[model samples]
Target: MVSDRNMLANILRTELQIHKSSFILGSHSLICIFIYSSFIHQHGGRFHLSPLREL
Candidate 1:
């Protein structure tokens, strides 16, 4: 029973980490896309990606 509990805890922890990482990655990509699109619109479609590196 103790081993079962430990296994369950480990599974929960792994799932939590996977969810957290995916959430962070999704938000970061969204921010990058938004910034890139806005930059393109502001600069008349010219592609200068230097500012995105700062973020």
Candidate 2:
């Protein structure tokens, strides 16, 4: 029973870590995109900095 509890706790900890990492990754990407767009606009859309523009 103690081992089961330990396993459950480990699983929950791992899940939380994964969630936190992905959230961080998502926010980082958002910030990059915002900066990239801002630069493009400032440069008069001539830079073509992001390949994601075709999407």
TM-score leader: 1
Report lDDT (CA) for all predictions: 0.89, 0.86
Instruction: Rate residue 45 of model 1 by lDDT.
Output: 87
Estimate, for each residue in 1-55, the C-alpha lDDT of model 1 and write its tens digit: 9999999999999999999999999999999899888888888888885966643
On residues 1-55, what C-alpha lDDT tens digit does candidate 2 reach at each position? Answer: 9999999999999999999999999999999889888877877887774646643
What lDDT does candidate 2 reach at residue 29?
Answer: 100
* Model 2 score (lDDT): 0.86
Candidate No. with top lDDT: 1
TM-score of each: 0.81, 0.80
lDDT at position 49, candidate 2: 43
* Candidate 1 lDDT score relative to the true structure: 0.89
